[model samples]
Target chain A: MPQLERLWNEFKDKGLHIFHVESQGTSEDDLKKFCRAKGMTFPQVMGQGSFSGYEGGSGIPYAFVIGADGKVIWQGREGYHAVITEEMAKVRFPGLGKGSVAKGLEKAAATFAQKNYGKAMADAQKKLEAEKGKSSADAAVVADAEHIIARATAVGERLQKKAENAKAEREYAIAMATYKILEDGFKGQPFGDNAATALDAMKADKEISKEVKALQQLDAMLAQLEKAAADEKKKNLKAFAEKFKGLKAAEKADQMAANL
Target chain B: MRRLGATVLSAAFLFAAPVLMAQADLKGKDAPDFKVGSTINEAQALSLDECRGDVVLIKYWGVN
Candidate 1:
């Protein structure tokens, strides 16, 4: 647990967001106290995690590393210290540690940090090409530029594949969400443009749009239900499941209602 | 009562956490949303949806 805390301290600003979820059915109050006692600063989610999709193995102390592209990249109970660090290193610009990026790549790095992969890559590469043999730090600057482009391209590709896979499986919600990430984060990049086109195409389909709306409705309702009483949640959830019948999110609503 | 009831229901899950964390098998799988009670240590609780373009480490822990 302390190790995870240390990891968070090391990379919190580098696109690493940690959520300390309470799965032992610990009350929110107790969860807060526990976190306080340990001086932990990451966000803590108090709930009985369904542990859905959990194939079951190492119980408790388990983890799931969802990448910047919204795909689960790594998961395990232990021995993942290196994996965690390595995964984080992928997101930090210049494909390096938490150090300040090279001076020549500052503007590009700022763009990348803003989640603009296409522009950042193009900017960095253009700068790299222009710097061919001008500076004494040619080798170092060239390396950073290449790393940024490669890493950005990799993230964009993975998200493209994930969105495609989700759409192919008719998981509209996941597909739409991923496509949005690509559209917003990739900019003029190839995969990012492809995702944007696909997203526009998806919105044009009546059936797909309906499915997406149903998902949005479910998410909005769930957000509302968070503050609601148990009895109220049960009642509302029943109505939602019946109304949004046949949708996965509605099925989830059913499960939540039953558990309530 | 709402909070207490949630605690009780979450406890029932004690006997049923997932098998093991399997990144290899679960890669690209849509992670199911877990029950959320409150935000601790942060101003707002983060849903998986809000984590796009960011790597989120969901550490499921327990304390009696």
Candidate 2:
């Protein structure tokens, strides 16, 4: 392990960027201690959930060898340093090397931060689509990553709206939703001072209550629909009937018939 | 030569595959088996076996 760490430190200066992906359950302190003990100075990452996406899935210390075209050419499980070292040696140096996906992602994140929504969306979509079939051993983690990225993109769309046309109320709502998505969706992300300030501004606004109420209404409606679906599946006519009672008389009749 | 290379590769995987497989299942399932010091100020190794039969709180953070 010391030898591998030394090798990584020696070659990291020459386009060997290491990205550590910590699992949802893993303690960051352990990662920090391990990295510090090994004298590593690489970017450490955390996931939304367990292994959910790539065909094989990914976990801590997994490595990706992305091609010059911003596509992953090689991906390996944890502690497979020699796979990377040997492959990188065989390939040309100072050239278009691996980890284009990470680079592409970093570029997209930068563009998003700069409020370049159009370019950022395009880059994010490309990066996500390109990672379609790759899987690590864990399915849940992969699923969480996919779900988190989707939620992030949706939040980005709302934020993009706020960026383009700054309607006070809409911006406030979008900003609040964005904060929640970032906080809940991607744990341990470096949400800088700007996000903090924007959230504070939104919280102080008077119209926040109205937006909150509206969101509550949406949640209630969704819960109603979910309960209705579940009741119908169980053939619980009384439960289904009770759930549809708040609807208009005609709509109630229609729902009752649908359930029947 | 080719057979020797295959044998070496197979041996390396046999030793490393389970560790890699376990690491890959970090999210969704119960957290991975890890033993870290309980308190930041302390130097005790707390393993999952020690925390068994109890609800354990797991927190992930970046140290500055």
Candidate 3:
């Protein structure tokens, strides 16, 4: 993480950004403490979904670099500092190896490719704002940034529609996943807010509430049964059998108890 | 001996249950978005969208 911080410092002016995502259910306070303890300064966000399948998702400390063209130029589980530096070097502006406005465009392209539409749009907007009423070269950069914003917004809307469709079909899990994509993938956008609203509505549904409770009960029962079966004491086994006597799993519980 | 064996088998099964839970494959795919408050700036909420247009390095970790 310190390596990443160094990299962020080195390339931030050249249009490099780092977003640290906290996985494994760590609280914000603990994450802050960790950052303070490590003297880290890059921006961080808490992960909303499982990090099981993202780039280098097989494990922790995964990274991916997106080119200004909105494509993933590099990704890996380690050595991101070296990998990103090399990739950024390749995208260096003409006669300007680092810290150039052109390089910002390249970074914006990469962000768009990564599907971080909101950030991509913002970056492009910033460039346009900074270059307003400047030279023709500046105008070109502004035009490019505008193009990125338009493209990113279109893609975001498409994703939002897909999430809405999933909700319409009553595919709660799929809808939730899609909404999550919009909520997280297109933050600060209308789609993101729409996704949040849909999710909140789902949480308020009585049927979903009942289903959640049933699943929780089932899970508790399974844990109890597993514990009772693993116990060597005959008294515990008999007690479990009696406790679950009216339940569907009671027969299996009894059989396991008898084996004890 | 039979009772002991049964207990050992059941214990093994119990331990394996969590491991059997599903793990999604997210590598080489577009990263998902999430929201978290920033430690550097108090009362500020941050999200993945904020890092757009730059090379984003995300580390998923815990304090252990």
Candidate 4:
């Protein structure tokens, strides 16, 4: 884990991304604690959707690396370290890199890179207005500021679409998270307002609210499953499935019990 | 996609083959997009294409 953390620190500026996919219902608190203790900074999330074409090997720490071209470049348990090193060297981000940012726009660019789109847009907008019609140096700031605005706007729209798709698919948790980001993160934006309206309408739906409650309760129940002994956890899961009967939550619980 | 431990992996041959098959089947193809079932630290879900044109590593792991 520390090695992975080191890799992240070394290559994050070079555009490397590492994410931990935990399928076994480890509580967010526990996962955060574990990562903190290990000094990990990369995103760690629970698994979803048959891993979208990748296989979950029967191992604790196996990994798969996708190249900048979005192809599976390397995959294995611990052997990935050196391979990642090699793959990292091959990356060449077009028109963007750590050193490409204009000095005047660096701060805003940093915020944008951190995914703080709201703050990034605000800061960049200020720079854009100030630098507009100024000298050649100012033109650099103006260009980067416009780039930030364009990227952030695109991301906002994409998230809005993602939330709608999640809502249609009945994946309420994901829909809510995406909407909350749009609503809170993009506060003054039109997309944010739309997301807020969509979220309110969804929450008002009786069927959606009922299912959301079931999934939340199921998440709460699974938290305890992480600590119990093997046999006890199985028994508890069976009971859980029955408890959630007739709801989609039951199917998820049933899958866990069967896995056990 | 089911359980997250070696015990579950060995217990179910059903999962093992598919994982190996996927490794063989999907190599070099545009990586299939993974979903955020839930986030452990992030505020929102991310689509794989969100990081398009950058190296992304998915480390599939378990607490136990």
Top candidate by DockQ: 4
| Selected candidate, larger DockQ, 1 vs 4 | 4
Model 4 segments more than 4 A misplaced:
A1-16, A19-100, A113-115, A129-132, A135-139, A229-235, B1-64
**If scored against the real structure, what TM-score would every candidate get?**
0.52, 0.26, 0.38, 0.52
Write candidate 4's Cα lDDT for A124-214 as tens digits. Answer: 8888887774655466677768877877887687788888888887788889889998888677778778889998998899888887898
What clash count does candidate 2 reach?
23
Best-to-worst TM-score order: 1, 4, 3, 2
Top-scoring candidate (lDDT): 4
Over A83-154, each residue of candidate 1 has an lDDT whose tens digit, in order, gives: 767777556432222234567797887787777888888998898888785756478788878867876786
Query: What is the C-alpha lDDT profile of model 3 across A72-122, one tens digit per residue?
Result: 555656666776787665443211112233545988766655557678788
Query: Clashes in model 1: which pairs?
Result: A56-B18, A56-B19, A56-B20, A57-B19, A57-B20, A58-B20
Show where candidate 1 strays beyond 4 Å.
Answer: A1-14, A17-98, A133-137, A165-171, B1-64
Put down candidate 2 lDDT per residue, B1-64, tens digits, no spaces.
Answer: 9999999999999988876664333332443444442232211113343222222223222233
Show the lowest summed lDDT stretch of 10 residues, model 1 chain A. A92-101
Residue lDDT tens for model 2, A135-173 = 642444333334335434554444434433433444344
Model 3 local distance difference test score: 0.59
Give the Cα lDDT of each candidate. 0.70, 0.43, 0.59, 0.72
Specify the poorest-scoring 10-residue window by lDDT in model 1 chain B: B15-24
Q: What is the C-alpha RMSD of each candidate to the true structure, in Å?
A: 14.8, 21.5, 18.4, 12.7
Docking class of 2: incorrect
CA lDDT of A90 in candidate 1? 57
DockQ measured for candidate 3: 0.15
Task: Give, for candidate 4 chain A, the lowest lDDT window spanning 10 residues.
Answer: A92-101
